[model samples]
Target: MRQSSLTGGAIMFTGYLLFFIIMRALGLLEVVELRAINFIFLIAGVYTAISLEKKHLGWGFTYFQGLGAGIEATVLGVMPFAVFIFVYLSWIDPEFMVYIREHEPLGHYITPFMAAFVIVIEGCASGFISAYTIMQYVKAHTAHPHE
Candidate 1:
C-alpha cells in the first residue's frame, strides 16, 4: 500500500475503535441508539484519514482531491465493518437473526437489505463532512514543527 493508504487506514481504524469502546462504555452502543453516533465516528475517522493523507502525500485538498480522498478513506474504513458484520452476524452471533427479528424486524416493513444499505448512506454523509473539515483544517494550519 502507499504511505497515505497505510496511514489513512491506521488512523481511521484506531479512531473508530477508540470511539467504539467509549460509546460502548457509555451504554450508547445499543445498535438502534448508536446509529447516529456511528455516523459521527465515520466522519471523524475520515477527517483524521484525510489529515494524515494530506500530510503524507503533500497534496493540497482541492475539491476533487478531497472528495476522492474521502471516498477512498470511507471505503477502506468501512471494509472491516462489513467483514465484521458477516463474521459476527452470520457465523458468530448465535442470536443474530433472533435479535434482528425482535429489534429490527423489517420483513413486515423494510427489508434486511435496506437496513444494511443505511450503513453505506451514513458512511457517505459522514465521509463528506469529515473530508471537507479536515482538508480545511490542514489548509489553515502552518508552520509544522516537524516540517
Candidate 2:
C-alpha cells in the first residue's frame, strides 16, 4: 500500500508539474486557470494510483483502502506544486500576480499567499472528492456477495 501510494503520488506530481510547465511555456497558464482540463489530469492521477493499489493488493483492496490511497497520492503529488506556486509568486514572477489581479474575477486584491492557500484548499477538496468518487466504483465492482 505504501509503495503504491508513493508511486502513484510521484506519477501524479510529475504529470501535474509537466502540464503546468508546458502550459506556462506556451503562455496558456492564465487562459487555463481553474478549468476542467486541470481536473482531468488530477482525476487521471488519482485513478491511476487507485488502480495500481488494486493491482498490487490483488483482491485485497477495500473501499477505504482505495480512498486512502487516492488521498495520499493527491496530497503527496500536489505539495510540490504548491511550493512551486508559492515560490513563483513570491520571487520568480511577481508580475504574474499583477496579471491575475487584472484579469481574474474578484482578483483585484489577492496576494501570493492567498493564491497558494486557495490552491491548497482546492487541491485537497478535489483530492477527497475524487478519491471518494473513484472508490465507489471500485467498491461496487469488487464487493462480494457473501461479505
Candidate 3:
C-alpha cells in the first residue's frame, strides 16, 4: 500500500508537470489558474483516495482516512511542483510580472491566500485522481491475471 501510494503520488506530480509545461509552451498555462486547479484536485483526490483506500484496506471510505491519504500524496506532489514553479517564475521569467501586469489584468492583485487555496485544492485533487487511476488499473489487470 505504501509503495503504491508513493508511486501514485510520483506519477501524479510528473503528469501534472508535463501538462503544465505543455500548456506553458502553448501560452495557455494561465488558463489553469491556481484556484481552478486546486478545485479540480480536491474533487479528483477524494475519489482517488477512496478507491485506493478500499483496495488496500478492504473497507469503504472514511473522511479522515481519505483526507489523510490525500494530504500525504498532496505534500509529495507539491514539493517538486513548488520548485518547478519557482524556477519558471524566477529565472525563466524575471519580466513575468511586467508581462502579467500588462497582459493579465488580475495578475497584480492576486493574493497569497488565493494562491495557497489553489495549491491546496490542486494537491488534493491530483492525489485523489492519481490514486483512483492506479487502483483501477491494478484491479483491471488483476482481474485478467496473466499466466
Candidate 4:
C-alpha cells in the first residue's frame, strides 16, 4: 500500500508542479478559477493509489485500506507541492504573492506558510471525500472473495 501510494503521490506531485508551472509561465496563475483543476489531479492520484494498493492486497483489500491509500497519497503528494508553492511565492515570484495578498479576502493576513497549510488541509479533505465517493463505486468490485 505504501509503495503504491508513494508512486501515485509522486505522479500527483509532478502533475501538480507541471500544471502550476505551466500556468505560471503562461501568465495564467492569477486566474483563481483555474485552481479548481488541481482537484482533478488530486482525484486521479487518490484513485491510482487506491487501485494499486487494492491490486497489491488482492483479496485483502478493504474499505479502510482504500481510504488509507487515498489519504496517504494526498498527504505525500501535497506536502512537497505546498513546499514548492511556498518557495515559488516567497522567492521565485514575490510579485505574484503580493498580487494574491491584494486579491484575497483578509489579504493582509496571508503568508506563504499559511497558504501552504491551507493546501494541506484542503488537499487532505478533498482526498478523503474523493476516496469515499470512489469507494462507493469501487467497494463492490473490491469485496473479499470469500464474502
If scored against the real structure, what TM-score would every candidate get? 0.64, 0.87, 0.56, 0.94
Tens-digit lDDT string for candidate 1 (23-86): 6578654566655556655666566565556665564434456456666777777666655544
The TM-score of candidate 3 is: 0.56
lDDT of 3: 0.55
lDDT (10s digit) by residue, model 3, range 22-102: 776888755736435544443343345445764675534344554466556666666566666656665676565446555
Q: Backbone collision count in every prediction?
A: 0, 0, 6, 0
Better of 2 and 3 by TM-score: 2
For model 1, where is the 10-residue window of minimal lDDT? Answer: 107-116
Ranking by TM-score: 4, 2, 1, 3
Residue 34 error for model 2, in Å?
7.0
Cα RMSD, model 4: 1.3
Q: Per-residue lDDT tens digits of candidate 2, residues 26-122?
A: 8887875445566876787788889888888876777788888899888877777788888888899999989988988899878888887887888
User: Largest TM-score belongs to which candidate?
Assistant: 4
lDDT of 4: 0.87
